[model samples]
Target: MTSDAQVLAAIINALGAPKKIPSHPPKYRRAAVAIIIRIRPDHGRSSAHSSKRRHRQQPQPQAQPRQQTSLSKQPPHAEQPSCLDEIVHPESLDEFFAQTWVQSGVFEILFIERANKRAGDHRWTGHVALPGGKQASPDEDDQETAARETAEEIGLDLADPALFRCVGQLDDRELWTSFGRDFLMVLAPFVYLQLTPKSPPLKPQPDQVASVHWQPLSLFLDRLAHPQWTPMVINLSNKLAPRISRTILRPLFGTMALHSIEMPYKPEFILRYQQELVKDTDMHEKAHPCSFSHSHPPYPPAKTRTVAMIDHYPDWDPGHRPLRLWGLTLQMVADLLELKDGPIQPDIRHKVWDSHRMRKRLDAGHLPGFSQADMHFWVRALLKFHSWQQTEKNKPSESNRVGSWESYYRMVKQAFVFVVLGRATAIAVLVRMLRAPMFRMIQSSVPSVRHSKLLK
Candidate 1:
């Protein structure tokens, strides 16, 4: 079995070479997140290669001369205040690495809670997200964008290649608009292996980050964490289904959230709102189907409906604490855990992945809360539902439909058994033929019964 460090190194190297820096860069607004890995000393022997070999494969950081000074001068906020630690001054990269290495198998990952959004902004505000934002003009590539964002959000410098190791990148993902009508911003997640023994004591930018969390990688792997699930309602349900994309972020982020089928439009909901509007009397004419007034402008009164539309998401609280981790952040953690295994493990992978694969129709706006396994079974159920609906539309008798489904299921079971029996028989014959000479001779003699019978 490969060590954790070896597996991570393999993943990074396997990410392949990134594309060249485009002149115009296609004008697509992009974002990038850094998945920083802090390698703890394994009790077993380490298989790390020389620094020279590793450095040769890594892309050199393009440092801006004035960035260090400019970042230091920014005014600090009163809330969630942070202080930058003394910079580590080392004689050489070797010295820096030597001082930073520690003897622990546990690794740490970082996440940030975003500050509350300003009013009227529909984007993800006051959400827990990875430390990243829209790519800036100065960013030469996605790597640079990730590095720059990390430095700005948390005072860690990626430009100094000696201080950090760029372990390649995960796939890119898209953050869509509130209505899911179009792509809000495209995100590219880059993985980094922190050379320092301890995680960087970050000075978070208060305006952007509400708080910083250095969560143990081991804690995530713990089955006890019991990642939570919450229902999310959005306009475009199908667009959010996790698709396997090479250029996009789907592969990298590795989908985790479970989505439900689009529900049929609720005419009753409209009626309820109309009744409430008429009760207020202010917009009573507007509420009536036939009543229309120029002054009213055919809009319901603001004080109309009293009920909330949707339920809160991230409902499954692992620790039942105030802090909750879900959605994209949780998905990224799941993907990182499977780095050594190669490709996301379906059985253990998120429900979003399986749901997206089985998804046929995209109609509903709300993703009802369901477990990873529930989503898997739901997908299979959906396949059956579609078949049933088609048959039902033809107005088949209840008894006939039941009989047909039962027969179909029985046939499937018999086919499976037949295939298993054939494969087993073939394996048994092959095994005897490949055995020792004595066994082979015995087999030939035993087969003499069949041989003679065939000859006769």
Candidate 2:
């Protein structure tokens, strides 16, 4: 049987070999992330790998004392070599099964969600992203950037090469931002195995981070794991009634983009809340806040207003609460898992491309342009049409409340606060500007008073 040390050594050796690294253009922005792996002891003895190892290591009964045969003389049995012979062979080492090793034992990686979520162009905000950021000048290279960002973001200091071993680099992929900042961003993913099994408590940077997630590596390797479709409705209703109505349907005035998302089920790595006694009912002390009780229905069920103000949303399956993973993060994970095709379904890719082309066409004036006045007219028309439809059906639409008196009152209160704040800011600026000049004038008058005193 191969010792655990031998298994780890084999992996380290395979990672040391040169890989076919992809080249990127200089104009593209470069970023890096560490695929941190924590190898745990394999507890499942029934696994094929474990069974094979057991079968190979089983002791064989000593050959029965050879009896002299009357007619035949059999050649003495060839000396048998240790199983470790194959593992130590240089050629066999080259063909070593990395997937078997990685998938054999229980392992997991770290993922983080960004805070201060921004909307529109920067749709990736608030999404689950690997602990990484854009490269800085202080970073000597992409690897350094990945290590430094990991330390800053998750408090994992990979700077010491002795602690973390680079498993190998994954193929580089380029992401050209279509919405927010128009630029080409390149991703360089570096896979790393934590040499030290016992890691320190993670201290995630709060301002830049919303939460930390530990994802099991097995989830990625699961072929059955598929991506979920998300509907993103871009509000193109000019600047007047922006964020009014959104739908997957091609808007006569707005745009609808379908974003491909893959949110795998929660792995065993993430710690769940422990059930505790609380007064009467059994309660979990650390329940997931975003999740709800089994009996209670999710509030504002998305289906209730699919075509209303909240058009941009994801389709969550029952018991499949997603972590909102999409965009570049999805691509990186797919690559790390050695997925031949990318994470997004091929058909979904076509739809997304079509949406992008549609957006481009609208921007190019291929469609009728909408003025701010036209947007306002559409807003009122939509409100009236929806109201009339509800009356005809004799049913109350939840979306109707978006533009109701209560909503208007809230809007008015927000506007009043904004006005008050704006006026106060302007007054403060004006006072600051006058104070400097008034101080100078007072200094000049003080000189005149000093002259008068000298004459006295």
Candidate 3:
């Protein structure tokens, strides 16, 4: 079996993020350290990579492997999977939340999640039991610091430094420092190896790890995604009702166009969460040219892209305005992020997209468009959108809460906070100014009575 450590070292080299090099003759950035415990299940004698076994308890004939048959080739012993055999999941780890999760210069994509948890009080909880880095004396390199810290934290041998991984680094940032300026520090990416029965000799040291043990990454993810998780998802369809209704949707009234779409659900869509938002056959049955049908998006053995959001909205055509926005957003975001060239520049916002020297990368295939560095920047902008404090205040709705009967008979909700915080002045004025609603309303009515929806 190939040493996981060696695999990790190769990965670090390919990532090329300077912070990961611990023996830094000239250190580039701050980083955190972690340990990737390889917990091999009892039946499967631990080996990180998959390779054929020459011998096993079950009777089998061993044939020399000239080359394993793949789609492009056929070998003498190529056989279909047995129908009676139980399906075993292939091992793998998923990229974290960042768009370039796998590609994050600061991150080291490591082990797969544990297949199943064992019953116990659960000190391991769900963590894979990674560790953090602490600087040793200035004399020590970051890699040295990592080895020292890991040994101190988990009682492992640093002399065999090759057991640890040196994944790249990410620039860490924190807000509201005691002195007022941002408090910035990086958590280096180095992982420790947890040997069996001993569990890496975790005898906690003071000023080292506050606590230690293994836990699945999923457990932490569960806590973060829980509704009670702090900074809960603030539902805005109500809070920003006035701004959404008055400003954004106002100008869009007449211009809002719809054509039932039928697009392919490629593997990328599956990775992005579109697989779960499966439309009913009826919807797919009637999909227009632009929309995806149910099946051409053959699920690939490996996945690449993912869907961002799938939610409903009221302001635009109730059929699915948000999907339309998401569709359009995906189209432009890839271009705007410069992952793809938008020279022909499809869609309305083409003029708004700024092209820089970075555009040259489009010609080069460091990626089809943006480099991994570009992806990090894109992620940063999204974070800004989440943390931005500006308001989107707006005009009041003329309709009085959908009438007493509907309010009494059905659930009614509105986003007062979002509306108050969005922008100044309700969006109704803009709608009135643009005369958009009236124009759209008139499309279904005689042109002479175009402004009639406003009367209602």
Candidate 4:
């Protein structure tokens, strides 16, 4: 078993030599996200206090004043210190990880659940995501954009060297709409490691962030120890609704299988205004007459209530439903974990779409919500589609440019046409073959109907 230090060392090394993707043309917007990592004492463990004491005995670095960056031009209140900074200026990341506290502590990554807002980008609303947004003007580079967004969204000043340091960066990713119809932006992910013993208290902006959470890194690295990943059935009909009506797409592509990990950490709600709204609701209920019998109990107090409505929207109640990590965020984590032969759980790693693998998995009953025969048929059809994609890759066309919007759009269009035609043809053929058997079975079951005037 690899120690956390060894794993983190590998990550640092991988990030140091990242395969960087150049920014696209000015037409494409750029965005950045910060993957904030920290090591905190496992309070649940008995040796937590002892570990802290041992950490204190180690040579402490002199605290230098945080340098003012362009991001610091914002209001002073945003930059106020919220936690004691126990900074460590290690000669190397290996030395940093070798610290007594780090070795004993639990590694954690920060995540924020976006508030469900009616306006703005509805695609990411109520999603468990990293603190980030589109790059604004005054930003020198993508890293600055990530830092500024992090501070604005969650009050975590990544620019503050006293509390955190930018360890390295991951490869850039191209954002696309469903079925790759349109290019949204290029997302550059930067990795930051907390220097303090305890993380600074986060003040999430209620309008943007619903809540903040720190999930243990172990959950992603070890699957057997923590079995959180489960199959999540996505309604493909809903995903295709923008292009085609759900009524038409429902029967063709009902659902698609994906994996999601249940978040274990309890979210600290940032929207304190919800409590006031809950209070108003309580007052309204008290004034109104009861619809039920007098014996029915009154509603719980606003203070006692576990859930509250905010902006006429229900906040993500973890108690009601566990927050699941999936989609792009999960993919980013997978990419980070796979760096330098890190101990990332095999199941969570990305797998290319292959017919043979699909068949093998289907036969072993690994894939749920799909029949063996249906998978076999679809896999065969997809093989042809895959071949076409390879052939196109070899050609010297403008659309052959990988990760370009035009190329992605072409592939999506081809896939859409292929899937629709294949499904329609398969359904038609099945119906035709079953038609004769159905007539024979019906005649045998209802002899009188066969000889009746209706049959004639």
Instruction: Return the top candidate by TM-score.
Output: 4
Q: Write one digit per residue (lDDT tens) for candidate 1, span 354-379.
A: 22221211211123332334333443
List per-candidate RMSD values in Å. 23.3, 24.4, 25.6, 13.6
lDDT minimum window of 10 residues, candidate 1? 264-273
Judging by TM-score, tell me the better candidate of 1 and 4: 4
TM-score for each predicted model, relative to the true structure: 0.44, 0.44, 0.29, 0.64
Model 1 TM-score on a 0 to 1 scale: 0.44
A best-first ranking of the candidates according to their TM-score comes to: 4, 1, 2, 3
Give per-candidate clash totals: 8, 1, 49, 0
* Model 3 Cα lDDT, one tens digit per residue, 188-219: 44433322222233344433322232333222
* TM-score of model 4 vs. true structure: 0.64
Q: In order, what lDDT does every prediction score?
A: 0.48, 0.49, 0.30, 0.64
**Cα deviation of 15, candidate 1, in Å:** 3.4
- Which residue pairs in candidate 2 collide? 121-180
Ranking by lDDT: 4, 2, 1, 3
Tell me the lDDT of candidate 2. 0.49
Tens digits of per-residue lDDT for model 4, 1-456: 126656777878766544455667744589999999998864334144444554688687677556744565778765342222233666666666655566667788899988866555686676889899999989999999999999998899899887888988876777766655566788888899998777787766767888788888877766423444377776656654565587776665656566667776466554544322344555646765672557544664455343333332325554566677776787677667656464222221212233332221111113334222453355445546765664565632221111322232344345556667777898999999999999999879787765695767
| Candidate 2 residue-wise lDDT, 1-456, digit = tens | 123334334434434322223435666468888877765534342145545755688886665656754235644432222222122222332343332333344566777767653334454445677888788889888889899999898688887654565667655544443232234666677877664434556766655665566665545444224423454334442211223333431244344233434445443222222344324122332343444766654343232211111111234345865675544565455444422222212221111112222221111112122233443344344445545654676643322111122232233334334444666798899999999999999999999999999999
